[model samples]
Target: MKRVDVAYVLLVDEHEENVLLVKNKGPGASYYTLPGGAVERGETLEEAAIREVKEETGLDVQLGGIFSVGEAFFEERGHHTIFFTFTGKIIGGEINISLPEEIEEVTWMNLQQAEPYIHISNEFEGAIDSKTTVPYMLRDAGRYRS
Candidate 1:
């Protein structure tokens, strides 16, 4: 199986009561997910997170540290994808679905209201539940030493 790296961002509004989500345009169009996508060749995980948010949601954001990591294996596609999720702040740019082919709409929803549409698999299951207080699935998935 081929390995793929993807980055996602959780952008909370000023009140911290709402989260930014994007509705995809294709088959799973009814579902909503955090703004993010596949990391491009030679792009850092941080760069990809920022870029995907901008491209998918038309929002310019500055990412905080990566908060969680999840893995998924697609047997049919032979893809083993590792997902890196980060917390981010909106620095500029307005909400718009720049990439219509990939995204249908972008909106903010409270944790409870957003819960049903947000689905996750594998290691991401517990971290992102609106039933609790914290919204983003924040976990210490790595450590660095020099």
Candidate 2:
């Protein structure tokens, strides 16, 4: 399987009561996720995170500590993906979707109201609540492959 590296961020408000999320335009438009994407070649994890957030949500962010590192292998896609998530603070720029076709909406939500839309990390259940969320990473992902 081809290896893919993905980077994401958890952008929290100064009060820590809200989060910035994006609703993708395609199949999963209904569900909301943190603003981030895949890491490009030669780009550092932090660079990718900053670039993705700008592209997806039009926000400039100041990244904090590494929040988590994980891997997910998808047999169907023939992909082994390594993901990294970091805590980020919005430094500037207005919130908007640069790629309308790929991203439908960008909005800030009350942490309490975002629970249902956020995908929680199972391995880190304690860290997977509404107030703090990491993208859902698959487990034993490619086991079905023969």
Candidate 3:
């Protein structure tokens, strides 16, 4: 069995037409993605999200609630990642490029505009489009199923 990991976040400024996204740094980095990272040992999923956002963007946020959850499997790497998506509100801090070593750029974009830049995982895309909250699953490199 492959190892599993968790990545979740509180998406700030979601009320606005556009939400913030980050361009990753280093090789194999995707086009753009929400600010989040792997859950650390002994930490809650919510804590991981909060820490990741701060580490990646230097923005402090208050977690609103869980928006969704999904599973993704990286076949080539033999890893299965389960993500908990949460809504968040920006409580403090300004947008500053803090983790330049890990993040290349940060930008706010409308959903439609973000589509092109987002690392297209059907699971993530479906979560954005769904009318009701649902768990989106991505396997290999295909559309979200179930």
Ranking by TM-score: 1, 2, 3
Provide the overall lDDT of each model, using Cα atoms, as 2-decimal numbers: 0.77, 0.77, 0.69
Against the true structure, candidate 2 has what lDDT? 0.77
Candidate 3 clash pair list: none
Give the per-residue lDDT digits (tens) of candidate 1, residues 33-72.
8899899886778878999998988789987766567788
> Can you write out model 2's per-residue Cα lDDT over 67-89, one digit (the tens) per residue?
66778889999999987878888
Lowest summed lDDT across 10 adjacent residues in model 3 is found at: 135-144
Off by over 4 Å in 3: 10-15, 26-30, 115-146
Clashing pairs in 2: none
**Runs in model 1 with CA error above 4 Å?**
116-146
- The residue-by-residue lDDT of candidate 3 on 1-146, one tens digit each, is 47566665535354656767888875765568788888877666667888888888888987765666667789887888787776677778888888787788878878667655434466567445443444433344432344
Clash statistics: count for each candidate: 0, 0, 0
Model 1 Cα RMSD, 1 decimal: 5.7
Q: Which of candidates 1 and 3 reaches a greater lDDT?
A: 1
TM-score of each: 0.78, 0.78, 0.74
